[model samples]
Target chain A: MHEMSLCENILQTLQQQANAQQYSKVKTIWLEIGELAGVEADALRFSFDSVMQDSIADQARLEIIDIAGQAYCSHCAKNVPIQQRYDACPECGHFPLQIVAGDQMRIKQLEVE
Target chain B: MCGICGCGEGHTHSHEEDHSHDSLDHDHHNPIDGHQHAAQHTHAQGLSPARMVQIEQDILAKNNAYADENRRYLSQRGILALNLVSSPGSGKTSLLTETIKRLKEELSIAVIEGDQQTTRDAERIRATGVPALQINTGKGCHLDAHRVGHAFEHLALSDHSLLFIENVGNLVCPSAFDLGEAHKVVILSVTEGEDKPIKYPDMFHAADLMILNKTDLLPYLDFNSAECIAYAKRVNPKIKVLSLSAKTGEGMDNWLKWLKAELELQRIDYA
Candidate 1:
């Protein structure tokens, strides 16, 4: 829902990193967004275009890497993949599992020159 | 106009006066035009193509850094800061005003009210005779850590005091932004659906305590208390639940007790 602000943050990061990284324009940006991050990939992509337009990453490509939500269920005794935080364990039907992974929004890499 | 794309928006650079990306064939050398924008893209030295740069940085790292600063500031001073989050019309301000009225004399209380475009919440808070700062987020949906830090600078909060950060009335967006609060207290009113916990699981999961407000209206509505608590547990097993009505003050005492306990704990920790 706040994808626009998120895109602006991405642009700011790109610009700040440009000085040290020795790059003028960003060619592609790869983001790892988890299902539990409360971010929609399509919404982020849509916001990326406007936020990046006319900037150093103008016309840049945004590649989102989807990270599946994983949580450890004591009943299952293992990590299980679920879509939402409130989802019940697929194997044991127990919910509110201990979250082990996902819920991350990070800039993994950038193709710059 | 951008010489590369002809987009008449950005500031025109001297080197890019007539430079076109299509005509670039190692034009680093002067081509009668001394204004060369070759520095726009730094030379790759040995690499011939675009190189991959590993960042592995959190997108919210800047905000998180600011939040960490706020956390350090509050924790060092033994200030108990609570971030109050809920949907619009969920009685967050009302509950805060009510809580302030009860605890203002006993506790050194301050408030930071956040809204998209109003000082209304802050006004309500100040009427309780406690120092309150209003942060109008403008187009922003949530109160960011940086903004909160600025507001904190202006508010004269005493040591061992309680700072209540009434965040923008948004459940989904505010769930992600941490405002350096000791805990996130989500106020869920019975007027809203009991299925809210499941629908907005991120907020329920992130929150440490869930306050079921407007219990006074529970008798007239079909809101099921048990089902709401169950759903909240389904999302967050460790989430503490408290049911109360800010209007009638039916269970406000419990909420007050919880706040006092947290404040005392912080004082102990600070000592």
Candidate 2:
């Protein structure tokens, strides 16, 4: 929902890491986005170019890694795959499950010069 | 848990240019500063090879850090801060004022009201004789933890008090940003569609409690209370629901009771 601000966050991180990692320009950024992370990939891509304008990572290509959602359903006593945050256990019709994975929105890697 | 995490609110990235990159060959202005020229090398073509740098950091890590600081500050003092989130016109202000009016005499009550461009909610809160501070987010869709941290420094929050943060009338963005609140209470008025829980399932799923406000008009409208709670539970089975009419003062005792219980829990957690 706040993709523009998120892009700005990426820019900030790129600038910070530039000092620590010693990179002048960012060629690409690989982000690991999970299904339940509540970020729209299209919106993020649309905002990336505008938010990174004239910055260190300006015109950087975005690579998104899709991660499916997984949760531990106690009723089934196993981790199950799910698409939505409110999804019941696919195996046992459990109303709620402990989210075990796929809630991440992270910057996994960056290609720099 | 670093206390300095919230210092970014006043930070300027101008220091980024001051860092002496190894490519300090430029007499004054360095154009290729963004590209980390880590190795001091003389490339024949003046081009650096592209290489992968692993970051593996959460996008919201900075904000989460600030939230952690705020949470530590509040929890250490035995304060119970609740983030009230909902779509526009969910009676969040009314419920807040009513909640304050009921408990102001017994507890130290304070408020932080967030809106796009108005202090009116804060004014309403202050009219109840409780201290209130207003945060104008301007174009922001929600209140972040950094701003909440600043507000915390300004407000005179005594120990073992109740802090109510009325977030900007947004259900989507606020669900993602934690403002160091003890719990997120999503309020949905019957006047709005009951299908909200399913329509915005992320908010429903993130909220620990769901307040079904404006139940006083339940008889006037065809608002089905049963289905609404069912949908909320379907979305979040552990979510607790409390039906109340903030305007009519009905079902407020249960709300107050819940507050006291949470305050007690906060005390136990602190001890």
Candidate 3:
């Protein structure tokens, strides 16, 4: 799964941040995973646990905040919550709506000590 | 006012006190050993709570950087790169074989076949007398930008060349990463329902062209060509849709024409 690779990147970023700040332990990690980011939250948590073993974040708590997918409906002239990219607006049946938000995947904050 | 630390006139002293209280609270709650607690306190002061917000860095930044580099590399070599995405057993190898057969005489073609394991697809492409390299992702669900970069090293791309990267049989994860291709062509066989574009819209949204493969088998299946096209068009209005049967060679002329047009477009850009 791509989650494992993403976990590896997370670990690398964590290691770099910890080294830069001279922190020996990371207590909690707040991650923002968007609904439309195509990444599974459970799978990412599972992989994070497996990949962070013996690393600085071994006992770290992962707090994942799921962002709802939002889209700008061209025909409706309003923002709509989109479950899938091609989903038509509930208010107006419009194809090819532009995505406004909810494709984000980022580490929001780290509680390190 | 220091932007990095967020320490203004009235906030500096209180911020230090609040920082100390936070570390003290952490020590009271977790109760780590003396040495570790001391080490943590030193670093804890530097942790501004403002770092929590406005860190608008994209998570896919690393992959996008690699993809940008790949685009530059491909541009320098004057190669028109296409990333082919589809479900497993969707006649990708067959399509590649037929495409290579048609274009190898007039165009320089190279292939990078991605699979979980095996060189079978590469072997099939090589049979057409074109150079093909196999990238076994080794249990990976999809190919990333870095892997494609590595594959480019072994490919001998010349001026006015075509390079096809057959991504691992996946419709989801592959859409999230850009491989620096001029076009992303997604194939859906007739056997796979017409509603696939609606079900997996990310792939359809990312795709520049959609090919309804295995059209020869349509009589045996319950697929309605019009419905499939409608679904794809609904998802991505700009997607060019083509129906073809790699087995019976039906509707291949359209595919060939699209390829030739892409090559000509690349030539025009180079000119």
Candidate 4:
């Protein structure tokens, strides 16, 4: 799975932040993963522990924040919730809704010393 | 393969320990009266308490940076680079071989083949009298921008040439990583399930064009071409589509025309 790659990316971000923030130890990490990001939270959590071993974030706890998919329905002229990319507009039953959010993977914040 | 850096072939998280912990002796000092009396400073007084640092950084920022560099590199030289993605056994290699055979006589064609192992695809492309390079990703599912940038160093690409990057045969992971291509052409054979577009919407959504290959085999199969196209359009309203068979040269003229038009457009935009 690509979750391993995403985990490595998370560790690299942590290292870069450690340099700028001067935090020798990272206690907990808060990751924001979107619904359409195609990342499984369980797989990411399983890889996070091994990926962070022996690094500054060793033994750190991972906190994943789930984000719901949001889109703008041009047919209905309103914002609607979409669980997937091909989801039709709930109000007008139209295809091709412009995606507004919930397709991003970002490191929101970290608790460190 | 190392997914983040693409350094080693089939290498895991194995490395020599280099982290030193020589700066964690907070039990010996007392800031109040300069006395090590009871060895009991549960919370270090002078040290700042743990705080939350705000870092709203995109996870794919690094990959995107590399992709941008590649885009600039290709644009400056007026190169028409296309990233072809598909599932296994989708006739991507056959399509490339056929396309190269048709265009190599008039243009400089090059290919970069990606697979977990083996150089057969590259060999096949090279047999068409064109330069080709094979990248063995060994256990890696997708090719990132960093590895593709590294591949550019070895390829003696000329100005105004066509470069095709055949991504690893996977419909899932490769959609997320942009390799600085002018367009992503996803090849879907009719042998696969018709519901693939709905099942793997992310890939179809990221693609600029979808090629419905193996039209010759449509007579024997129960695959409905109209429904498949509709499903793809449902996911990506702007994605251009072409139906072709890379073997019998059926509907290939449309694909070649599209490529030539895109190359001409790139030249005009760069000029």
lDDT of 1 by residue, B1-271 (tens): 1121122244232342264211111112111222213225445567665889999999987668778878888888999999999999999999999999999889999998888876778888888899888777667788877667656655867999999998889988998887788999999999999999999999999999999999999889999999999999998889999999999999998999999999998877632
> What is the CA-based DockQ of model 4?
0.48
Task: Give the range of the ten consecutive residues with the poorest summed lDDT in model 2 chain B.
Answer: B21-30
* Recovery fraction of native interface contacts for candidate 3: 0.37
Interface RMSD for model 2 amounts to 3.7
Assess each model's interface with DockQ, reporting 2 decimals per model.
Answer: 0.48, 0.53, 0.25, 0.48
Scored on chain A only, each candidate's TM-score is 0.96, 0.97, 0.95, 0.97
Which structure among the candidates has the greatest DockQ?
Answer: 2
Colliding pairs, model 4 = B1-B10
For each candidate, what is the lDDT?
0.82, 0.83, 0.77, 0.82
Docking class of 4: acceptable
Give the winner by TM-score: 1 or 2.
1
Cα lDDT tens digits for candidate 3, B31-115: 1112332233442465653222223346666667668877877877678899999999898999999988888889999998888
Ranking by DockQ: 2, 4, 1, 3
Output the better candidate (1/2) by lDDT. 2
Candidate 1: clashing residue pairs, number = 0
lDDT of 1 by residue, A1-113 (tens): 68977887787688767777877768999999998899988899999999888777889999999898999999989999988888889998986788887899999999987
Cα-lDDT of candidate 3: 0.77
